[model samples]
Target: MDDTFSPSRHGLGHSTNLVGRPSAWMASPGFNDAPVALHIWGVREMNPALFTMLDQAETLAEAGEAFLAYMVAMFGIDPEQRDAAPGSRKRFRSSFLRLIQGWGFDSNGPEGAVLKGWVESRFGILPSFHKEIIPDTQGPVWQAYVAERMQSRFHDNAILVQLDLLFEFCQWAVARFAYPGQSHLTLYRGINAVDRHGILEQQSRRAAVIRLNNLVSFSSDREVADCFGDRIITTRVPLAKVLFFPGLLPSPLLRGEREFLVLGGAFRVSIEDI
Candidate 1:
C-alpha cells in the first residue's frame, strides 16, 4: 500500500527546490485596476520528469488521467484512503472518463454539452458561435470563444466557487514539491472585480464586431492562420519578488470602492487553534 502511494515511484520525486516569492506583476501600478480577479503563479522551475509526463499526454482524456495521478501522488493519498474516502475514486474516474470521451468541436459532444448546460443553467448564458457563418477551420477559435464567454460570466457565485477549487489545486501542487533551481515557485491568486452590467454590454457588442469582422474576412477555403492572424506564445519566468495589499483584507485599501471578498488564500495544511 505504501509503495502504491509513494510519490517518488509515481514520477513525483522531490527534486525541484521550490521557494515561494512575492509576485512583482501583482504589485505593479494600476495592476489591480482591471475589473477582473486573477491568481497568477510564477514557477521558477518544474520537475523535468513531470514535464515529460505532461508532454506525453496525447489527448484530453490522457491529460485528465495524468492530472489525477499527479494529484494523488502530490496529496500522498494511500490506497486505503483512496478507497475509503467518499467519492474520491469516483470523482477521479468520472473526470478521466469524461476527458477520454472528449469535448468535441464547439462543445457538441456530451461533455461539452453538459458543461454548457451547467453554465447556462447556473449563469443564464450559453456560448454560441455561428458554425454556418464563421469557418472555424482553426478549431481553437470556438474554444477561445467559449473560454471568453465563461470569463465574462465570472460574477456568478457558483463559478467563483469552482475557481476556488482550481486555485486550491494549484496551491496544493506548488506546495507538494520544490523546483530544482535557485528561485522558488510562486503562486498568485486574486479575483478581478468587473462591473456586471458593463461587461455584459461589452460582450454583446464584441460579438457583433466579431461577426462583422468574420464576414468581411470570409474565404471559402481559408486556413485558420490566414483567417485569424493570431498566435499563442508561451514564456517561463524564473524569479520575482514584490508585495502589495500589505494585510490579508483588501477592505483597508478599497474603502469607498466596490467591496470584493478575497477568496482562497495560499493553500496549506495546518491546524488552527479555535
Candidate 2:
C-alpha cells in the first residue's frame, strides 16, 4: 500500500484552495447597466440641523464636533464610544486645528517645531523653509508662505494616506445611512479639472471618489444616487480615485441653493450624463 494515498495522511473530506481565486461576492452582478434614479439637492434639503450646526461652528473643534454630531444624528453612532476610540473625531478636530495653527506661527518656536515634525512624519517631507519677514504675525505673508508649502506637500504620497484615513472615518461615520441591503457607501470630493478635450470644467462638474478597497472594487460604470429633500440626482459614475482633494461642496454650485450633505447609493448611469 502506498502511504501517500492514505486517507489518514491527507483527509477524506474535500477541501478548497481559495488563494488567488476571485471572490464571487466582489462581482458587480450587472448593477452598472441597470437604470438608476438620481436626485440633486441643495445643502438645506438634507438634515437642516446639521447644516445649521456646521454654519455656526466658529473654531476647528466646534466644526468637527458639529460634523460628529451630524454623523451620530444621521447614522446612529455611539457618541461615547466614537469619542473614546483612537483616531476619533475629536482627534481629527485637534489635528485640523493644529494644521492651521502650525501654519500661522513661526517655524522655529516650540509649537512650530512640533508642527514641522508632524508634517515631516505624516507627509514624509521636510517642508521647504520660507523666511518670515515679520515676527509672530499671522498675516497675509505668513498665510501665503504656509499655503505654498502646503500645496507642495499635498503632492506627497503620505498625504494621500492621511486623506484616505479621513475619508474612511467619514464613511464609517455615515455608513448607517446606506440603502437597504448595501454594506458599503461611497464618498467623494467634487473637483474642477481639464479633461482630454481641453475644456475647463466647473466644480461639481467632476467628482473623485475616495480610494478605499471596498468602494474601488466596484466597476466604474456603476451609478449611485443621493436624495436631499425634494431634489435628487442619479446616474453618477465613480470615476477617479482620490485622497485629500477639496471643494466637496463647491461654493459656486451651491450659491443660490441651500446647503446639503452628499450621500451615496448604487444606481445606474454616468454622472456626466446627468
Best by lDDT: 2
lDDT of 1: 0.26
> Which ranges of candidate 1 are over 4 A from the true structure?
1-33, 38-67, 70-93, 104-106, 121-124, 129-208, 211-274
How does residue 67 of candidate 2 score in lDDT? 66
Clashes of 2: 14
Q: For model 2, where is the 10-residue window of minimal lDDT? A: 1-10
- Candidate 2 C-alpha lDDT tens digits along 246-274: 22211122212222122112222123332
Give TM-scores for every candidate, taking all chains together and pairing residue i with residue i: 0.24, 0.23
User: How does candidate 1 fare on TM-score?
Assistant: 0.24
**What range of 10 consecutive residues in model 1 has the weakest lDDT sum?**
208-217
Q: Tell me the deviation in Å of residue 135 in model 2.
A: 47
